[model samples]
Target: MDWSTKRKLEYFGILVAAILLFVVLPFFIFIYKPPTCFDGKKNSDETGVDCGGSCRLLCRAEALDPILKWDPRIFRVSLGVYSLLAYVENPNVSAGVRSAPYIFRIYDKEGLLILERRGSTFIPRGKTFAVFDGNFSLEERIPAKATFEWGELVWSRTTVSGPEISITNKALMREETTPRVEATVENKSLEPIRDLELTALIFDSDGNAIASSRTFLEYLDKGGEAEVVFTWPQPFPTRAEVCAAPVDVTLVLDRSGSMDDLGANPPQPLTDVKNAAVYFVNLLHEKDQAAVVSFATEAASPIESVLGRNFEAVKRAIERIAIRETDIQHTNIADGLLKAKEELVSSRHASAASQVAILLTDGVATRPEKGGDPGYPETYAQQVANDMRQSRIALFTIGLGKNVNESFLRSIASSSEEFFLTPTAKELRGVYKKIAEKICTTRAAVIEIIPRIYPR
Candidate 1:
């Protein structure tokens, strides 16, 4: 071996060893990182990234169903303005670059498009980012099924990597379950199951299972409560509620020739009558019905027909009733009550609830055939009262001003407790609520009142 040849050979060998130790070894180390396979690449979070033979990132597709740490699945529609949420979750990425653009598609059955939304955000890694609330409208009308995806920025370019979700419609109402009646089968299960199939046999007050409503339980997570609601039109008896239910009330006001006289209150009979009638109507609930019947010589047609469901309606009806104008040739108490009763009776439908009539008269009854007093005319009043009682009607009588027969007015009332015998004109408004309150009180089938005895 020559000395020069041997030295050159040794240098070549050292060079080969250095290349393998530094360059080739570092390349192999980078290629075999923890997420990398034997091939060499960075694994994607959800979508499995395809490294594709010596690429830095092993991008197959983002991993689907990344364990959601802060995923609040149950949400309210009100939280989002339009309807898009940015979902971001990455354990390794920086807080700033953690969140990416997400495309949300709400679909219906038959793969119909309901809503499609896009949102970009800075998602915190490992933390669920659902803050983006963009207002969007749903195109399709579907009962429940919905799906969402997060990955690609565009709908067409969406890369399915984030959570694969089976979106469900949030509960329509918060209190879905109501307190069930007693004597029913009790569910002993502690874990309240929502969307559970259940069969219910409904019974009337008579204890006969008349009809049944099919429904499923909706689970509310907060209080561990479950509510099941169903729609079934059961054969409810003609619920004879006196005045609690929404009703059309007509106040028959007597404003005839006899009402012109100023009795205890030195205005006019018509003045007190108008004031009292106005006050009475105002005391009614907004859902209640109201009309003022001011009768004079020619009997003015209902000043205001059935009104008073909203503020505007009640205000307008009050304005009409309070109008100070009349033809005071004669008084017609019986006629006004009869007309009011007829109006109320005719306004109701076969399916409607009961109606009420409040008749206010200052003086006695007078007509073409009969004049002055007419012996109180209790017969006509009684007839109207009887008719009302039979038809499940409630009649409230108010003896306003002076020259009013308290006994006759009492006889006209469906019940003795409903007659309003007021001594003063100014107290008319207070009396109105008292009468209305009496009507609004729950009228049950039967009540057994036990008198309480006390020693003084």
Candidate 2:
């Protein structure tokens, strides 16, 4: 406990502390690492373990959700095999998912879940894509509806655009028997491309994806080309409407004096007839051609002599046909029939399109007098109707009001179903609507195979 002994002990302790601070502490500081985004720790201000807060990778809660761009599509490949396709969208501009887990559930007609398909797919950067699952056997269970679901996706920034390739010369053949698609794929990039994948989609006339198949080409040299083929083991169902054919129809209307016998301000039956004719013309398909023919003392193609696809022009022509005060008292049914027949026969698509003639009359045919009285107008009209049918033109005749001769109007039609008698002008619109719908429904069935190459 003397001063010399105490001083010596303190000196020794100070020497040891100085050595530790300079040597051991310096070594530890040199090996130390600051908190980072990829360090797999939450030391820094990161939201998750190693994500968010200045990291290229975002946390699950920070990333925006992917969108289901379209409803899932299901197609039967064979007896029990089905193909499922789900169109997806990544709204982020520079962020994407490398691989994401997803689920597909198929439901029966009773709304019971029948199948659950689990799979994983890589979502590319900055685009809408497709995730497809195929060759699923329902085993006699038919799917009434299919749903697509997915869990949290790990998103990170990526600008990689995979495999610069182009598709060309696509051809779909043997659609009625065995459907097969033949196409060529070529690499446009200077570097070699590997594992090129492609998906094929067949859309119907309504642009709905009906059938799908996927094909792959393992590798391609720089600027190299190869042929890719996709085939369907089963043919598509033909009962569904693939195409709706255009129709060529001529609307024949009577503008005789008795048409306005109800004596309204704008004329009862005549005004209603014009409105019904416009409604009927509007109901026709956008590609259908229509012509207007009206008859009072004489039949005339008022605005246009030729059939045209311009439905507005056809409506205008029908509206212009009026029983004006200057018009004389006569109904030339024969001329109306002949004018309509002429328009239909000379139309541009006479052979390809469905031909039809709708005749509306309010009184008996009493024009073309032989001795200044009235000729055999009824006989001429009947003969023209028969001739119209011989040209494969379906005829529909409408008798308006109580004054019309039902027997004469019926004779002008091809069959009893084509004849309609309306006791009041108010009922005429409904009759015209019925005929318009019939014309649209009876459009000849056409087959078409649409091929689309979706890029990934």
Candidate 3:
């Protein structure tokens, strides 16, 4: 009787085990899932929610930060209205964000916040793009500084591709007082592109971007081209009053014996300097007045307060400047600057317009006796530079040759960036052109509205 009961129990146990293995286990397996990257919970080796480690997209800490190529630039459109542009670059080739918030802060000259505008835009992957904000108006406040700041960005993995386009030709033209730009864009891509956005940035010769504008194209077939135009109802700050606003500029030339040393190719330092000076004279617009002061041991004006419109006279004066042959044929930079200041002050256009002095030197200030302090020409030059700064006159110093004291030149200029150091006299013309552009153009009102992007 006991063996029969035991056998029945064993058979019942085997039947229960088979049912659990075949039916119950399969049912549980059908409803179960393994941990994956897209799952709501971060169970794998992920650094953040569904990111880092095995995920295609990187975690915030692992992703590269966006590069700001340049600071935001604000262009005054009218008395109260303005336009703004910020150039930003994404360094990651495969990371992109659908939307990124940004802020443009406008500040007064005293660094007081006038107003701020906030907006959001998409950032193209691995490409530099300009964020344009336009039609910003203030009742009577004028912005002296504008700054751009980006908010927290949520980047996602994306495949980025775009139509290849090239700028063929571009020019800035003013119709009356309004500023306009005409440019040609050519599509070189094999595929057609639609809704193409084009941006135009106008930079002065000093590489400071003054204005920016944007245009759009509906469609562009492969290998096709389009003419794009950007215009503003208000004139640029440089051309606000056209040639009516006068600028009195004095040229301070170094006529030391060392000026004969030709470091430039073809070896003609004086000739090159004169040619560059003449070129600078020609660059000045009408209603601007210029004077040439040559110096060695002494400073003398060749073209004493000549009007900029009298181009021939200015050229003749520049060409006539010769190296001093006296026993004291040493650089007297202080004397040259003082003579230039006198010319600028005595000019009829001086009081009504901007005053600028551009001093080009090939050697150190040698004639310290002429500086009113023997053996302290640099200190005397610094004093003169300080006086020029106090007078609100912009001073630009161009240092030619390797021996030219860069530190002294920097001290003489209004700012370090305003000092031009050229390895050879060949680059003097280019440097002069940049200075000329800055002199002729009005100083841009720079207002840094926002701080830089902070690291997390």
Best by TM-score: 2
Q: How do the predictions measure up, each by TM-score?
A: 0.45, 0.58, 0.52
Worst 10 residues of 3 by lDDT: 447-456
Tens digits of per-residue lDDT for model 3 on 402-448?
88888889878999878999987789889988886666555423211
Per-residue CA lDDT of model 1 for 1-456, tens digit only, reads 999999999999999999999999999998865654333333543233333334333233422333334322212232232233223344433122334465566655677766666665433333333333333444335423334555642111222233211112212111123312111112334433343333333332233322222333344232243334433222222222233356667777665555545553444655665666666666665456665566644345644554334545544553444323433356656566667766676634223445777877766665533456555455665666787778776888888766777887787788788787776567777877787677675532211111111111
**Ten-residue region with minimum lDDT total, candidate 1:** 447-456
Each candidate: what lDDT?
0.50, 0.79, 0.76
Candidate 1: where are CA atoms >4 Å away?
A: 1-244, 263-267, 308-328, 347-353, 368-377, 442-456
**Residue 150, candidate 2: C-alpha displacement in angstroms:** 0.8
Q: What is the C-alpha RMSD of each candidate to the true structure, in Å?
A: 19.0, 11.2, 17.2
Q: Model 2, 1-456: lDDT tens per residue?
A: 999999999999999999889988898899988888888898677888888877778888876788897889888999999999987777876788767899999999899999999988776666677787998799989998899988668888766665567777777777788888787878888877766657777765445677888866667788998887788887876422333567798888888888877876788778888998898887776667888888888887442435888888778877777775774768988889898888788735546688999999888888766664454788778889889989989999999887888988887787889999998878877998888777765422232222222224
C-alpha RMSD between model 3 and the true structure: 17.2
The TM-score, computed over Cα atoms with residue i paired to residue i, of candidate 1 is 0.45
Of candidates 3 and 1, the better by TM-score: 3
